[model samples]
Every structure is written in C-alpha cells, then in structure tokens.
Target: MKSILATILSIALFGGFNDIATVNELKNRAKKAYNSGDYEKALGHYIMLTDSLGVKDENITLNLANTYYKLNDTTAAINNYSNVLSSKDRSIKTVAHQQLGIINNKNKKFEEALSHFKESLKADPTNEESRYNYELLKKILEEQKKQQDQNKDQQNKDQNKDQQKNKDQEQNKDQEQNKDKQNEDQQQEDQKNKEGEQKDEKEKGEQEKKKEQGEEDEQKKEQKPEEQEGKPEEEKPANQDPSFSEKLKEMNISEEKAKMILEAMKNNEIQYYQQNKRKAKKKKDPDKPDW
Candidate 1:
C-alpha cells in the first residue's frame, strides 16, 4: 500500500513522471472511481484523460459509454458505444453491440435492435444475452409485420365498401332522374291527346250543323215557288158564309155603299180572272197526261 501510494505521488508530480506513466495513472484513477460507483468522478477523469491522450482508447470509450448509460444520457451513451465498435478487441466490440441493441430496443427500433443483437452474436457466439435478445426481437418484428398487414387489409376493405356505397348512390340518382323524365313525357302525351279529342269534338259538331243546314236547303228547293215566297194568306172565319151581306156587315158599311163597292170589286175580279186564264192557256203543254 505504501509503494502504491509512492507510485501515485510520483505520477501526480507531472514534471517528474513520463507521459506514459502519467496516462496509466489517470486510467487507473478513472477505473477505481468507476468500480466504486462514483460514475460522475469517473466520467470527469476519463474526459480529462481523453483530452490529454488525444486518442480514444477502447477501454476508456467503453467505460465512458457505460457511465453515460448509468447517468441516463442516452445520446452520449449511444455515441460512445458506437465509437467502441471500432475497437480491435472482440470482447469490447461484442459488449458495444449488446449495449447498442439494448438502447435501440428501448427506442422502439425493433429491426435495428435485432440487427445489433445479431452483430453482437457474430462477434461473440457464446454471448447468451445477445442470443436471447436476438430471438425475442425477431419475434417482435414478425408480430409487428403481421399487425401492419391486418391494418392494410382493413383499410382496403373500408375503401371498397365506400366505393360500392357511392356507386349505389349514383345508380339510384340516375334511376330517379329517368323516372322523372318518363313522367314528363307521359304528361305531354296525355295533354296532346286531350287537345286532339277536343278538336275532333268541335269539328264533329260543326259538321253535324252543316249537314242539317244542307237538308233544310234541299227541302226548300223541293217546295212550290209560292210557298218559298213567304206570302201569308188571309184566314177566314170558319163559321162565316161568303155572301155580300156578310161582307158588308164585316166592313161595317151601309148597304148601298157596300153594294156599289161590291159591284166595282166584282168587275175588277172578272178582268183579273180573264187575264190569268189567257196566261194559263198560253203556257199549256201540247203533249199531256190528262191525270
């Protein structure tokens, strides 16, 4: 213990110690702090040593990564662990891969975690932790893929259902439009028929009136000329006698005047009858049926 203390004191006197011995002393101090669970002290010492060394020692980088992980500084831990992957030591590379796999799994990067675990196993095939984690991550990836496929299928089915619904709606709309068009056409046809029927009835009525008028004209043509002349004959009293006395009484005249007027009328009637008899004889047919 006293010799160890003497060596430490010699290393601390920077001017007396060689650079290699000083660096070894720093590494030893950092490792002692880390083993004692004084991660903050170990981290500070390692940082100072890395700056002095001007090189990333594999062991120091690995210890820094572990310290960062313990401090819950995932970004720093991941960066340091990645640097440790370049170490020539297979053990260090295996541990780095394992830590990276654990970090990626925590971040929900299952595929990347699986890949890291596989790389860890390749680096050290006897790493039980890496092998177990690899199998577990593989199963998780498979389950995630299956879940994604189910979601995709469900989306496709929903899309198809929506398309079919839209198609049916459009079809129904078309059918309604056609039905309305058909109704309009039928209404127009009915209106046309109604107008035609009314026109036919008016024409028929006019024709009947014309026919009756024609029949009346023909009847008038068949009548005697005198009858067509519209002359009205005097109506004599059925109970009266055609005598001079009766005529005088009907005229309310004196007997003498009535006798004189009757004489003049008799003369005029005799002359009119003679002229009419001559006209009738002149128009007599030579070839005749006596009936």
Candidate 2:
C-alpha cells in the first residue's frame, strides 16, 4: 500500500510538469515561426498555446495577435489584440493598440486607425512610431487640399489668358486691315494724279506744235514780194536838172547788191557786220559799188 501511494503521487507530479513543458515547447515553436515570417504556422501554434494549452497566458495571446496581423487577417488580429487589451497589462496594451492602428490603416479604416493611435499615445506618450504615422497622415490630408486649390487657380488663370489673347488678336487683325485699305486708297490717288499730269502734258505738246507751224507760215508770207500779178515796165527819160534823186540813187546802191543783201538776211545765215557794211557802202555810192 505504501509503494502504490508513492507511485500515484510521482505520476501526478510528472503529469503537471509535462503539461507545463508542452506549453513552453508550443510557445517556443510559435516564436520561432513568427521570427521566420511564417505567420500562418506561427498563428496556429500561438492559438493552440493560448486557447488549449492554457487560458491564463497573456503573453501567448499577444503573440497570437501579432501573428494574425502578419498574416494580413486584420479582423482576427483586432479580436486577439482586444483580448490583450482586456488583460490590463500596460506594455502589452500599448503594443497591441499600436499594432491595431497599423492594421486598421492597412484596411482603409482611417478613423478607427486614428483612434487606436491616439489611445496608444495616451498609454505611452513617448511612442515615436505612433506619433510619426499620425502626423504624416495629417500632413498628407492637408497637402491634398492645398494641391486641389492650386489646380483650380491655375485653370482659371489659363482661361483668362486665352480670352485676352483672342481679344488682342482680333484687334490686331482689324488694325492691319485698316492699314491695308489706307495704303490701297493712297495708291489709287497717286494713279489718278499721274494720269491727269500725262493728259495735261499731251495737250500742251499739241498746242506748241500748232504755234510753231503758224509762225513758220507767217515768216514765209513776209518773205514773198508784193509785186502785182500782171504788170509792165515803162521807159523813163534822163534827168536834166539832177537835183532830185530816186530812192536807190540817194543811197548810191546798186540793184544787184541790194538784192543779194536781202536774200542773205532772209536766209538767216548772215553772221558778221562786214556783210552789212558792204550793203551800206553799195547803197551810199552806187557808181563805185561792186555787185
């Protein structure tokens, strides 16, 4: 009876120690898988250690939440992380809140993510990673608003510039057309003036030719003698007193010499005074004059 009691007591102690050893072994395997980035395998082991190995293991629950987050199962991760939060462990709660915020941000739940980050800061005010992500998201939202406003301003400016350019182009086109019309009118006026001048010059030329012809005809008429068409010469008697002389006798000029001087003057070829002196001497001394 003493031996059987000792055997039973040894078996109970060993069984309790075996349960503790299994819990520790499962936790170690989960840790190794989590560190190696095998989140699915790590999550399985962590869950087993927490739910089946023991219900009072806070550390395993936290590790299980982190493994769920690594597996991209945000819902499960949040649930396990909330379990850690209910534990009232400040360090674990802070870490769990931080991880929950990151998971919520990844799921496009910005409001929930912000709440978790704020709660984390309240738990540990010096959490640099939480502070940085919060400020970055705020800055991104503000910059997006500023960029939208700037784009609207630039679009308005472009439209106004286009309208002003069209106005200026139209004004310039009208001015150019007006200038061209003025130049065309000036050219037409110049042509009309030139035609008038040509007409005047042609009329003046005709008048001058007619005057020159009339002057030539008058000069020919003056050069012709005024002798009658039908007349005869009469015989004259010799002068007995010789006191009254004829017109040619008074000038003592020969008839032949007088005729020659008249012909030279009519031809307009007499160039010297000697031609006139010869004619004057003939008229003054007709008896001594040479024809």
Candidate 3:
C-alpha cells in the first residue's frame, strides 16, 4: 500500500501532477473525516476522489464504500463493495464480502448475509469476525426453521380443534331444533285430543238434552190423551161438561151404586154451601150504640 502511494506521489509529471495531488488530498480528507465520524464530509471527499477525479484504484473504491456505509447509504456502499469484489487482492475481497454480509444482515437477508460471510471466510481464513458472523447467522436460521415448524404444527392443531368445536355446536343446534319440533308436535297432538274430547262432550251433552226434551214431550203427550192418540176428537153434543161415566172414571168407581153415592154426596155439598150462604146473609152489622 505504501509503495503504490509513494509511486503515485512521486509521479509529478506535467499535466497530471495537480490532479494527482488533488486526489491524494481528497483521499486524506475522506479518511480523516470518516475517522472523526463526519460521514457527510467523508462522503463528499470520497465522491470527488472516486467519481470526479476518476480514480480507478480498488483500495480507493473500498474507502469510498466505507464512507458511504458510514453515511448510511447502503445502496452506494454495496455498489462500491461489489466493484471491489473483482479485485485480485484477497484482503480487499475479504473486506468487500464482510461489508456486504453486514449490509445484508442489517436488511434481514439472513441467507445472503450468511453466504457472503462464508465467502469472506473463504477469501481470508484468518477472518475471525466473518467466521463469528457466519456461525451466529447459521444458528439463527436453524432456530427460525425450528420455530416455523412448531408454529405450523400448532396452527394445524388449532384448526382441528376449531373444526371439532364447530361440528359439536352444529350437532347441538340440530338436537335443540329436533327437541323443539318434538315439543311442538306433542303440543299439537295434545290440543287435538283436547278438542276431540271437548267435541265428544258437547255431543254427549246435546244428546242428553235431546233425551230430556223427548221424555218431557212423552210426559206431555201422556197427559193430553188427544195428542197421545195423534188425532182430533169427534165433536160431542152441546152439553160439554163431564158426563157421569167420566165422573165415575175419575173416582175410579166401577159399580153404578158407587156412582149414585157420589152424586148424593155432591148434592149434599151443594145444600151445605147454600145454607152457609144464608147464614152469612143474616150476619148483620151491629146497631150504633144508643147515645
């Protein structure tokens, strides 16, 4: 590194002396600014050396990549680091791969970062930092794979449980519906039986009423001999009063002497009534008291 810088500084030829001095000055400023944590200043100086001055040195490109990384510009940093990867210098390859691994790791590209770390280690077997990164990232990926498998198993178990719960709920709902239907059917059957019983009772009551009315009508027919005979009687003579035979029939008398005795009793009752009427007529009001 010293030999190359000495050779470049020693070449103070005609047209390129000023350019070479400017490039060296920019390189010194960029290095100092980066060491002092002034990434913006370092980025400006490095950009002038690499882009403006057109310095094609891989070491300068590596320095520019480092400056960009310090400025948190991972895109430009990765671009410069990738350019350094083609350098024949094993140390530069190691650094370029290590920087890419770090950038990829920061962006959570674990696989690419691990691959870069492995390449960094391959480029320089003594790079303990890259080896550490490779081992750590490998463990992290393995743990992630394990966790993913466990999560998938748990998710499957939860899905099966939910399906079984839903099935049980559906069965319970069906059972409840069936039970309600049975209760409704039973209620309808009970209602039908009750209505049938009520109808039968109503018909029985009507039959009893008809029976009672029929018995009353039979009694009335028995009392009225004409209606019992179902015909009008023949017209009689003008004397329509009860005859002696009817009287005898009323008295339940079969002998003619008993009928004569009933007639004598009737004549005596008439005489007694006439006598009582004459006594009532003789009963006069008392005379006014003599004053």
Best by lDDT: 1
Give candidate 2's TM-score: 0.43
Q: In model 1, how large is the Cα lDDT of residue 113?
A: 91
In the range 1-291, model 2's lDDT, one tens digit per residue, is 343244335435657524766566667767887899877777767666555445467788788777877777778878888887755777787788888888878887787887888887778778888888777766765787699889888988898999899999999999999999999999999999999999999989998999999999888677624222112233232233355246557889765666666566645543444465466455455567565
How close is every model to the real structure, measured as TM-score? 0.66, 0.43, 0.53
Best by TM-score: 1
Candidate 3 Cα misplacement greater than 4 A, ranges: 1-55, 148-156, 194-291
Question: Per-residue error at 172 for model 1, in Å?
Answer: 0.8
- Candidate 1, residues 197-279: lDDT per residue as tens digits? 99999999999999999999999899867444433334343335558567667889777785576567767776776676567
lDDT preference between candidates 2 and 3, better one: 3
- Go through the candidates in order and give each one's C-alpha lDDT: 0.81, 0.71, 0.81
Q: Give per-residue CA lDDT, model 3, range 1-291, as digits (tens).
A: 343354345444423534666677667877887899977777776666666567778988898899888778889899999998967899999999999999999999999999999999999999999999999999999999999999999999999999999999999999999999999999999999999999999999999999999999888867855334533234343235548567667878765676466567767776776676577567455685545
Worst 10 residues of 2 by lDDT: 226-235
lDDT of 2: 0.71
Task: Write down the worst ten-residue block by lDDT for model 3.
Answer: 230-239
Q: lDDT at 39 for candidate 3? A: 77
